[model samples]
Target: MARDLEFGDFTPAEKRRITALTARMVLPRANLTRLRRQVEDIEQQAERRKKK
Candidate 1:
């Protein structure tokens, strides 16, 4: 089953795990800059949502 994510609810370690997993999925199709930007964007958006 799938669980909804609350980025603010995660610890730093959990956040890093999420980021690493996402990078793994993205690596095959993306260059380093693209991968970095995608991860940064994900983190930034999640942070914005969490503040709401």
Candidate 2:
């Protein structure tokens, strides 16, 4: 049998565990900067291609 489990139904530890598992990971500063630069480069390339 499948039962729905609400967030409130979890104990404090269970809630914390669930929250930690589901949280988004923080990217490192260097990686974030590299990703931003790559995105900007892609956008510039798209603009150049659109002008052609």
Candidate 3:
């Protein structure tokens, strides 16, 4: 069986709280993966700008 996920709109304070909580819950491996992805994205953008 599949379940549908519910999404809600968050106020600025609520958004900040949720982000802080999530950051606390993130594992080191997951954090490393996120940093690698961000670095790759930045590098790709730099390469594109260089080609322009």
What's the lDDT for all of these models? 0.61, 0.45, 0.46
Candidate 2: regions farther than 4 A off: 1-30
lDDT of 1 by residue, 1-52 (tens): 0144566655686578667856676566657766566666666656656668
Ranking by TM-score: 1, 2, 3
- TM-scores of the candidates are 0.45, 0.42, 0.42
Q: Which candidate gets the maximum lDDT versus the true structure?
A: 1
Summed backbone clashes in each candidate are 0, 0, 0
Residue range 1-52, candidate 3, lDDT tens digits: 0122112333355445545545755665567655555544544544454456
Of 1 and 3, the candidate ahead on lDDT is 1
- Residue 1 of model 3 has an lDDT of 8
Candidate 3 lDDT at 46 equals 45
Candidate 3 lowest-lDDT run of ten: 1-10
